[model samples]
Target: MSPRRSVADTLETRQRILERSLAIASAEGLEGLTIGRLADELGMSKAGLLGHFGTKEGLQLAVVDEAAAVFSREVPERVKQAPSGLRHLRAVCEAWVSYLEREVLPGGCFFTAATTEFDGRDGRVRDALAGMNALWRRDLRIHIRRAMSFGELPGDTDVDQLIYEIVGIMLALNHFLQLEHDAAAPARARKAIRRLLGG
Candidate 1:
């Protein structure tokens, strides 16, 4: 029998299940995630697991939010730890590459999977993913603007264009890392970022 869980313990258990669910979704896509599979993975009863998620949509939404929170917490912290301007921009690029390479999601990057999974779908999941993408793009714009202010980048640089370029680099690097064993992509990305930032 499972040990008796206090109210707080139960909440913590639910959090763990949600985190694991995201990882599983990342690894196998959302279609492969189910309450029964999660219960088996966690060594709990299906009914008990269902009690936490209630529905598949509920579980999917929770995973999307969790993935966003994870990115917000990790990437900025790494960037902030670096010197401002060009160095910070480089650090942010490195942090992004490292995050994808780390395989925080078993399938790959959470956004990468989500965009492919729900991009054209009209519903809560698509909205959630879109919002997450918007937020990240905004954050990147802020950094790019700061870089400009510091004279580390061109004065006439378009934030949107820079963001698009950076996103493309990140996506390319992610796919290369996922398909090949080469670490060259990250270095290549750093070089590209340096060129754009005028390092």
Candidate 2:
């Protein structure tokens, strides 16, 4: 038998596998991720791949987890660098749109593709996606709440309704960029956001 691998080696291999899997899932959907294909792509045996992820669902879940990690670093963490309150909320919107515009993934955004893929399907996949979405929405709400606390926004502002509108606008931004191929979508999104938040 081959010599035993170190802990670091194992972690590296798993990270590599998840990175490749995320790319495939981003461009094509989790349905397109297959054991045989991943093994072939990685130049590893199917059995070897199975050693890392016992099931395809497990691999998909891992991919979703990594995607969220990437999104957190790229968007939320970056936005939080701004001073809290209305400025923070605006920063969040700008960073979010910039993340989409930067093409971090072939799918524009991993969650966007995953959401469309698993929206109607009930399973661990949908649950995982929903959890990420909740965190993201919660972040937005927190920033809005901060704005109210800082006196940047009126205390009477309807947080839920404001979140609904902002989220809808971001969805439209993704739709326009991906489906409509609208070059102006990002600019229009920022404009709409400023109008919504009265920036």
Candidate 3:
């Protein structure tokens, strides 16, 4: 292959690896990603996989990054056109619900599974997950503050508490949809959100 073609091939292979890794991690937790298993699954050599990522932790971190990118595309990016403050907040939440409902990953939310898997552990993977979760919470806080300023929400609204409840609704939606196989969970979640926002 020409040098440019070789580079393109390498990029394609790396993307394929990360895509498969994200799916497996979403369903089975990051602990389930073994190089040998991936190699067998992809019909690639273990060394080739290792070359793509220098170590298992490296691969896990890369998968986490890919998951974050996917989330950005599915949720926040989809809501970018909404006017800021309450409208943006509502749009993003609906986008989140839709993303989960659509089953973007074979499993439910990748972060939900990852956080459960690594919450007790200490490592780069856990830190990366935590950072992403924190950023999400922070984004919610920003929207809440904006809504308050715009008088969409009461001035005395408990920002942290509202965020907690909103996140709780999404978590419950994921559980109901995935574990209980509840088809109405998304509607219920939207109802709860509207109730909380008084919309």
Best candidate according to TM-score: 3
Where model 2 places Cα greater than 4 Å from the true spot, the runs are 1-5
Q: Report the C-alpha lDDT of model 2 over 1-199, residue by residue, as the tens digit.
A: 3346676787898999998999889889888999999999999999989899899999999999999998888888886668889998998888989988887877777888889999999999899999999988898899999999899999999999999999888888888988888999999999999998877
Q: Which ten residues in a row have the lowest lDDT in candidate 1?
A: 1-10
The digit string of per-residue lDDT tens for model 3 on 1-199 reads 8999999999999999999999999999999999999999999999999999999999999999999999999999999999999999999899999999999999999999999999999989999999999999999999999999999999999999999999999999999998999999999999998998766
TM-score-wise, the better of 2 and 3 is 3
TM-score of each: 0.89, 0.93, 0.98
lDDT of 1 at 40: 89
lDDT of each: 0.81, 0.89, 0.96
Decide which is better by TM-score, 1 or 2: 2
The deviation in Å at residue 122 for candidate 3 is 0.8
- What is candidate 2's local distance difference test score? 0.89
